[model samples]
Target: MTTNQLVEQIKQKKSFLCIGLDVDLNKIPQYLLKEADPIFAFNKAIIDATHHLCVAYKPNTAFYEAYGIKGWQALEKTINYINEKYPEIFTIADAKRGDIGNTSTMYAKAFFEDLAFDSVTVAPYMGKDSVEPFLAFSDKHTIMLALTSNAGAFDFQTKEIDGKEVYKHVLETSKSWKNAQNLMYVVGATKAEYLADIRNIIPDSFLLVPGVGAQGGNLQDVCKYGMNDNVGLLINSSRGIIYASNQDDFAQMAARKAEALQKEMALILG
Candidate 1:
């Protein structure tokens, strides 16, 4: 989806909540395991129950990849279902993919062309060439990792480079690359305090923020520092929403959790 389209969806729904479908098979309700594809079954129910409450759905690819081929097939089916039924809901493949130029291009093609995700998260540690391939796809987005929520982010992302934090340099340098306009960023909600500085560097770029809810990242604090004129934030909640219950009524409980977040977002957006 285009930036304008995404902005419109945020406006229309009065929300920027991105439900993280980090579907772990072992964590889903026992009953779903009886289905031909439990992961997809769980995802379908969650999507159907909470689609109206959020503007985006992000599937962290690692969850499926860990399960091997069957998991990948389920991942494909889940995304196809979302595209077919809720095309307006922006989809993100949280694959965190970034590699050598040639490999990056193949990875971009896999997610952008084959799987047809609206966006995919990428790592910029490989520099401009590694990340540029993902950005080259005009119709899709490349969400580069920056100031992540993980505790280990300090090991490198905050390291000083030419008198500036490495993450700041990444943001500055990336803006000058080809097809840079298609770049979004992963700014963890836990790093909300740095968002004002990050925003000054790229005022219009959307940020896919994970670390809310289960991770204890404050929504109000994130909005305070990260929001822009277009409200460029996709705050994600994975465990808190997806694992709300391991019972048969999991989907309903998930919807309630999503509704609470969406209502909170509506007030913040207003």
Candidate 2:
């Protein structure tokens, strides 16, 4: 989807919430295993129950890749289902892929053409050549990893390069790339303090922020610094929402969790 389209959805829904479909079989309810395709079945239920409460859905590729072919199939089915049923909802393939130009092109094609995701998360370690291939795809977004919330982020992202943090360099340097307008970024909610500095670098670009509920990232703090005139944030809550309950009412409970967030977001927007 186009950036304008995504922004419109956020406005229409009164939310910028992005639900993470990071399904792990071990964590899902045991009853879903009886279905023909447990992964897809679980995803379908969750999507149907909560699609309206949020504006985006992100399925981390690791969850599907771990299960091998079946997992991949389920991932495809889940994306297709969302595209067919709710094309308005932005879809993200949380596959932090980065490689050589030729290889990155293939990865871009896999997610953008074959699977038809609206966006895909990408790593920036390989520099412009690795990321431009994905950015080249029209109407699709390449969300690069910037200041992540993980403990290891300090290992390099925050480390000073010359006089500036590596992530600051990444954000500033990325804007000069071809089709940079299509670029979004992954800024973990745990590092909400960094959002202000991040916005100063790229105030208009969207930010896909994970690490909210489960990781204890404060939503209010994220909005306080990260929000723009367009409300440029996709706050994701995975385990906190999807795993709200593992019982038969899992989908309902998930909706409740999503609704709570959406309500909070509505107040923020107002």
Candidate 3:
């Protein structure tokens, strides 16, 4: 989807919530096992329950990769379902993939061309060449890793390099790429303080923040520091919403969780 489209959805729904589908077989309700495809079954239920409350859906690729071929098929089915059913909701393949140019192109094709995801999360450790290939796709977005929400992020992202943080450099450098306009970023919600600095570098770019409910990152803090004129933020809540309950009412429980977030977002937007 286009940036204007994304912003429009945020306004129309009074939300910029991106519900993450980080499903795990061990963690899902045992009842779903009776289905022909439990993973897809769980995802369908979650999507049905929370679609109106969210502007985006991100399925972390690791969850599907773990189950091998069946996992991949399930992922394809999930993406197809979302595209056919709710094309307005942005779809992100949270793959965090980056490689040399050639391989990166293939990766881009896999997510953008084949699976038809609206965006893909990419790692910038390999520098611009690795990430630019994904950016080459005009109709899609490249969500580069910025300041992440993990404990290990402090190990390098915040480390000062030439008196500037490594992540700060990544944001600055990424903006100069040929297809920079299509770039979004992954700035963890826990590092809300950095949002001001992040905006200083790229105020207009969308940020896909992934740490809120289960990770304990404050939603208000993120909006306070990160929101722009367009309210450029896609705060994601994975485990807290999708895995809210393992009972038969799991979908409804997930909807309740998403609704609470959307309500807060509505107040923020107002």
Query: lDDT of all predictions, in order shown?
Result: 0.93, 0.96, 0.95
**For model 1, what is the alpha-carbon lDDT of residue 179?**
96
List RMSD in Å for every model shown: 0.7, 0.5, 0.6
Residue-pair clashes per prediction, in order, are 0, 0, 0
Report the lDDT of model 1 for residue 122. 92
Better of 1 and 2 by TM-score: 2
Top-scoring candidate (lDDT): 2
Q: List the candidate 1 regions with Cα displacement exceeding 4 Å.
A: none
Worst 10 residues of 1 by lDDT: 22-31
TM-score of candidate 2 relative to the true fold: 0.99
Residue pairs in steric clash, candidate 2?
none
Which residues of candidate 2, in runs, are more than 4 Å off? none
Local error of candidate 1 at residue 113 (angstroms):
1.0
Off by over 4 Å in 3: none
Per-residue alpha-carbon lDDT of model 3 for 84-121, expressed as tens digits?
A: 99999999999999999999999999999899999999
Tell how far residue 15 is off in model 2, in angstroms: 0.7
